[model samples]
Target: MNISVNSLNMPLLECFGSETRVRMIELLSRQPMNIKELADALQLSSAIITKHIQKLEENGIVGTESISGTRGRRKVCYLIPDSIVLQLKAPEPPEEHGGSGYAVSIPVGQYERCSVKPTCGLASENGVIGMVDDPRYFSDPEHVKAKHLWFASGFIEYRIPNYLVGRQTVTSFSLSLELCSEAPGYNEHWPSDITFSLGDTVLGTWTCPGDFGSTPGVHTPKWWKLGTQHGLLKTVTVDERGTYLDGVRLSGLTSADLAIGPGRELLFRIACPDTAEHPGGVSLFGRHFGNYDQEIEVRIGYE
Candidate 1:
C-alpha cells in the first residue's frame, strides 16, 4: 500500500517577508513603543513608519492602546504581539512517503502509588518520602513538584500517534522523549534498565541506572536545590540498525525487521520492569520547569 504524507505547517507572517517590517519587529521586541518613538528609533519618517505600522497592524503583529496620565491627557502607543511562533503554512511531505503509523502509550498516573525505599535523598513540598536538605517552593500553580522514590518495579506509559509510522523500506525511526534521573542534592551515579516496546514486541532496552549528574532542570522548583545532576534525555533515535541515546547509537537492533509503519499502527511503550535488578526512575519536566513537557515532541522526518 502507498501512504502519502505532508510536512508540518504554521501561520505565515505578512510583515515577515518585508525588510522594513522585519526591522520594526526587531526594535519593538525590545519594548512597546508609540509610533513617534518607533519612528525616532528607526530614524524613518513618520509617514514611512505609519505605512509600515498600518501593514503590521493589519497583519496582527502590532497592537495599539491608550494610556492615561495623571494630567488630563492620554497617550497612544503601539506594541508587538506578546508572542510570535513561525511555522510553515503547508509543509510538503517527503518525496518518498509510504508506510504505517506509529503509536505510543504512557502510564503516567500509575507511578503515583509506587514507592522507592533507599538511603537516598528526596525533595517535595507536600510531604517527605526521602529528605530534601534544601528549601522547597511551589509558588506557581503551573509547577509540578514531586518527591518520589522507588525500586525496580514501576514505569510510565505513553502512546504515539499511528499517523507517524511510515514505509516498510524505512531505514531508521527516531523516538524522542524528555528524561532525567530522580534525585536530591546530587546523584551522578544512578542507572536502571529502561525498556522499549513496539506493541507486544520488545524493540530494545537501555540502562538509565545512574544519577544524571549535575544539570539544572527548568521545571524543577526554584526553592529546591540547584545543580542537581539531571539528564535532559531527548532526541532518542532508533532503527533496525540499533537503539540510540540522543545521537549516540547502540548495537542489537533491526529496523527493516520491525513493522513500524506497514499498516497496523505501531505503538511504542517504555517501561522499567521489576525484573531488572538495577532500576532507575525518571522525572519528567514540563511547563513549570520553564520548559514544555509536550516539548518532548516526535515527528517522523524520513527519507
Candidate 2:
C-alpha cells in the first residue's frame, strides 16, 4: 500500500516513532502472527504488543483476520502493505511577476501514439473495454473512456498542447499521473524501470517498486477484479533548475533543454526501455481508477 501525506508530522510520527512499533512492523513483514506469537517473537508482554497492534491497525498499516483455533477462533495480524511511499509535495516558489501560465488535463487513455505488447489491456470505470493482453483494443474508439491501461513493455506517447509559449514565458512544465510497475498477475516485489521523455530530452527514469494488488485501489471501480488493480500517483516536473520526481530533483535537464516554441506540440512519452534492468512493465491509472482522483495533469508555469 502507498501512503501520501503533506507532512511528516502528526499521525505518521505518532504511529512509527516508537522503536517497538518499528520492530513490530518488521516482524509482520515476514508473515502474519497472533498476539501470542508476536509477543514471544519480540519478547514483549501481551499488553505492549496489543497496544502497538492497535495503533498500527488504526493507521491502516496492519490488518487482522479471525481464524479457527483450539479455542474456537482467534485473530491473526498481518501487514496491510508490503511497502510505503511518502510523496512530499514540493514547496511552492514565491510569487514572481504575477506567475501566469495554463494547465491542461488529458484523459489517461487518449494517447496519440503507442506500441504496447501482450499482457496489455484497457478498462473503463464500469468494466473492461476489451480483451485482456490484446493490443488492438488500445485503438478502439472507446479507449477515450479507459480509466486504466497496462503493458509488459513498450511505450505510450501523448501530445500536450503548448499553451504558454506565445502568451507567456514558460519557466516550467509539470506532468502528474498515477502509475506503477506491471506484472503478469500481481507481484509485490516486482520492479520496473519506467522512463519519461519530453520531446527528444530524456527526463530520467524511476524504478517502480511493484505492481500493487491484494487491496483494492482507493478509487478503483468495484466491478474491477482484485488482482488487476495497479499503479501509484506520481508527478514529474521540468523547471528552470532541473527535472524532478515528486519534488525531488532527478536530473540536470532544465526548461531550456525543452525549447518550447509557438505552434509546437510537447510530446510526452512513458516507456519501459528494452535495456532496463527490471523490464517488468507498466500500469497507468486515470481519473476513475487508482488511488488518486485526477488524470494526466500538465501544468505550465510562466513568468
Candidate 3:
C-alpha cells in the first residue's frame, strides 16, 4: 500500500525533530542500510537505535525487513518510507494558471530560424538567443547524421506563469544544456566560460572544460564526422540559494532573497563570449534527453 501523511499537525513535525531521527532519515535517503550499519555510523547502541526505529515505524515514517542468511538465520533492520507525502491543512485551492512546467528538445534537426550560408547554427528550443553556430562544425539535423558537433552558445527562454502568486515560493529552479569541443582535429582539455541571467540581473557564470569529443555517442547519426565530441553543461540548481554546474557548487546567486511568486516570470539566458578563442557552444538536452530531469520547474510549499 502507498503510505501517506496523516496531517501537518504539531505532532507530525515533532517526529522529525530529534537529531538522531533526523540523521537516521538523512542516511536512509541515500539507500537502505541495516540496523548494524546505522548503529555503527551513528555511534549509538542497537537498543537505542531500535527505540528510535520503533517510533518511526509506528508513525509509518519507516519500515523494517528481515533477510535470511545462508545459515537460515535472519537479520532485522529498518528502512525509510519509499516516498513522502506532505499533507498540508491549508485552505488554498489548487493552482489554476494556464502555463505549466515543460520540457522541450532542440535537436540539430530542429531549429526555429536556421541558415547555412554564414555558419551552421539553430535557435534553441525556446528561441531566446539568436545567431548560434560554429565554423568547425556543420552537421545540421536537417540532413546529416552527426556523431559530434559544437556551437558558440545554446539557450532557451521560458515564460513563468502569473497565477502562483501567493500560494508558494520558487524554492529551486534549474536549466540543462549539452557542451562539447569547439574545433575539429583538436582534442584536449579545452575550457570555456558561460554566463546566465534572469531578466536584466546576471545570475551566475561558469567555466566549462572541453572534456567531450567525437567518441561515438548514443543519439548521434552514423554518418557523423570522426572528430565530433560533446558534454552537457547542466546548471541544475539555480535559485536564490546559489547555482551549480553539474553537481559542483559555483559562486554567485542567492536563493534567500529571490521573490519567485506569481507576478514574476523567469527567463534563463546563457552566453558563451565570442572571444573564448576556443569558442565551443552547447547542445540543449530538454525533456527529450532527460539529463537534468526538468526543462524548467518552480517549487513552492505551504504549511
The candidate maximizing lDDT is 2
Q: Write the per-residue lDDT of candidate 3 for residues 23-142, one digit (tens) a residue.
A: 998887777677778899999998888788777654445555557767674434434233333434432333434333323333333322222222234333233222334532343343
**Candidate 2 residue-wise lDDT, 98-124, digit = tens:** 457667789998998999897899998
Ranking by TM-score: 2, 3, 1
Query: For model 2, which pairs clash?
Result: none
User: Following a full C-alpha superposition, what root-mean-square deviation does model 3 have from the true structure?
Assistant: 14.4
lDDT of 1: 0.47
Ranking by lDDT: 2, 3, 1
Clashes of each: 36, 0, 13
lDDT of 2 at 58: 49
**Tens-digit per-residue lDDT, 4-73, candidate 1:** 1222111124457688888888887777676677788889887898788766654334544446656544
The 0-to-1 C-alpha lDDT of every candidate, in the order given, reads 0.47, 0.79, 0.47
Cα misplacement distance, residue 226 of candidate 3 (Å): 7.3
